[model samples]
Target chain A: MLRHAIALLSGGLFGSGLFISGMTDTAKVQGWLDVFGDWDPTLAFVMGGAMIPMALAWWMRSKRVTALTGEPLPPAPSKEIDTKLIVGSVLFGIGWGLAGLCPGPSIAALSYGGPGLYVFVAAMVTGMAIAPFVRARLDRAVPAE
Target chain B: MPIDWIWGLIGGLLIGTGGAVYLLGNGKIMGASGIIGGLVDGSGLNTKWERILFLLGVAVMPVVLYPLYRDVDTHITDNYWVLIAAGLLVGIGTRIANGCTSGHGVCGMSRLSVRGIVATCCYILAGGLGVILFRHILGVI
Candidate 1:
């Protein structure tokens, strides 16, 4: 119960931060991405400011075995820099630039976002729904490492 | 109304703190794409209820704080097909790659994770090039 509450608080804080920073605004995101055409640097600050506390958290967690909730920490980070990551990132960037809504903001913006946002999320979820099948099929064809 | 860098910084800090809270207290990564992506891709099946509750918590923030963003226009493109295409790409790409801005860009970079940095770079570069292509060359922003 306590862990769940913490999760809720964390998630809520995240959502509020996204909203307060104007991340939920689609134009703000595209404006930041538009480096060549009237660039907006506000979003950059958002990332910069966010990094400070997060870095500290990582440093602190290195000393601990479990979280405040007694749950184990996440697994070690992956060191591999493979092709799938790059290709997928490239694909995601195109979509982000096109629509200006990444997953975090997309979910939060569902409240007041118009029909366009609705369609985008629906399509995104649909895409997600099929990803496992694709991965499974790929695994069967070629044993993953 | 244009360059609110200070607010961005403030919000980013809050965002980071939120992530920190989740990480330190819940022992979880506050990665939006990873959290939601895992659910759709079968990776988070063992923790579905937690995921659902986390998402509900996220979704409710906007509703509760609607007053702040009441005037904000999300600026979603007017084109429905375009929206669909964008959404599909975000979904498939993030799942296949395993991260997004929050996952790899923010939290990932904070930890100095090579995967996070690389993924973030790829998407940022791609998004920039994409803007140049669609918005500049094709005039289809």
Candidate 2:
């Protein structure tokens, strides 16, 4: 019960933040991504500000014993840069630039009750649904992590 | 081109603080990717009602807040098809990469996961390249 509550509250706060920041509005995001043409560097500042606490948390966790769950934190998984990572990154970038909405903003945008959110969410779910199949096929060839 | 940095700062603070609270109090990483993925996979079926309620909250908060800044124009340059294609691609990328920007860049990086660091870096590079390709190279702007 507690865990579930925490998850809900955390997500709610996150969503609220996105809403307050106008990130749910796709145009704002596109402005940020349009570096060469009317670039909005505001998103960078947003990201940077967000990174501050996250950085502190990482530093503190490194010195701690157990996580908030009282269980031993999993050792950070380390992996080499591979083709899959590169290809995946490229795909993500292209989509973000084209649509001006990523998972975070799209999920937050659901509040507007618009067709665009519905379409984006549907496609996101479809992509997730297909992931297992793609991973399985890749596994047969090169055992992805 | 001009952004409201004040709002961005506020958003970042909320995400960071909220994420930390969840971690310290609940021992969980607040990754949107994992939460949404779990929703679809039925991993949270035991608490289905709560999940639905949570999702409802997420979907309604913007409406509640929209009244304050209703005057702002939220138009985009791209058409519906472009946005749709972008959505499809992001979906696949997040799945393939095992996370999204919030998942990896914010939550995972906070945990100092090496994977998170690498993933975030890739995200930035890809985003940069995409902007260059679309706006400059292709003159799609």
Measured by TM-score, the strongest candidate is 1
User: On residues A1-145, what C-alpha lDDT tens digit does candidate 1 reach at each position?
Assistant: 8887887888888888888888988888888889887788989999999999999999999999999989998878989977668878988999999888899999988877878878988989987887666556645765657
lDDT of 2 by residue, B34-60 (tens): 556656656556656545544555666
lDDT of 2 by residue, A22-113 (tens): 67766667777766667666676667767777667666777887766574644565566655556565677678777677787777776564
Where in model 2 is the C-alpha error above 4 Å?
A59-74, B1-3, B41-54, B70-78, B135-141
lDDT tens digits, residue span B8-127, model 1 = 998899889989998999899888888898788788888776777778877899888887554577877898888888999899888878889998988899999999999999998988
* lDDT of residue B61 for candidate 1: 91
Per-residue error for B11 in candidate 1, Å, reads: 1.0
Per-model C-alpha lDDT, please? 0.86, 0.68
Interface RMSD of 1: 1.1
Worst 10 residues of 1 chain B by lDDT: B67-76
Candidate 1: regions farther than 4 A off? A136-145
| True-vs-predicted CA distance for residue A30, candidate 2, Å | 2.3
Candidate 1 whole-model C-alpha lDDT, 0 to 1 = 0.86
> Lowest-lDDT window of 10 residues in candidate 1 chain A?
A135-144
Residue A46: error of model 2 in Å? 1.3
When summed lDDT is taken over every stretch of 10 residues in candidate 2 chain A, the lowest stretch is A69-78
